[model samples]
Target: MPILTCSIPLLLDDLTELCIAYLRDSLHASNC
Candidate 1:
């Protein structure tokens, strides 16, 4: 449980970054 708690934030951060990159790519694709 302690390890899961600690890793949750890191998982969220990675997910957030992936979402941002995906959005950026989508925007660029639409623009082009």
Candidate 2:
């Protein structure tokens, strides 16, 4: 198996979490 595929999911999950956190932070900031 390739190391790239093994890490791809983790990378994607991290990116998704980052985007979600950024969006949540912006939304909460707007409410304040």
Q: lDDT of each structure? A: 0.65, 0.65
What is the C-alpha lDDT profile of model 2 across 1-32, one tens digit per residue? 23334445666766666666776887899999
Highest lDDT against the true fold, candidate:
1
lDDT of 1 by residue, 1-32 (tens): 33345445566776666666776887899999
TM-score for candidate 1: 0.63
Q: Positional deviation of 13 in candidate 2, in angstroms?
A: 0.5
The clash tally of candidate 2 reads 0
Runs of candidate 2 exceeding 4 Å displacement:
1-11
What's the TM-score of each model vs. the native?
0.63, 0.63
Q: Which pairs in model 1 have colliding backbones?
A: none
Tell me how candidate 1 scores on lDDT.
0.65
Per-model clash counts, in order, read 0, 0
Candidate 1 wrong stretches, greater than 4 Å: 1-11
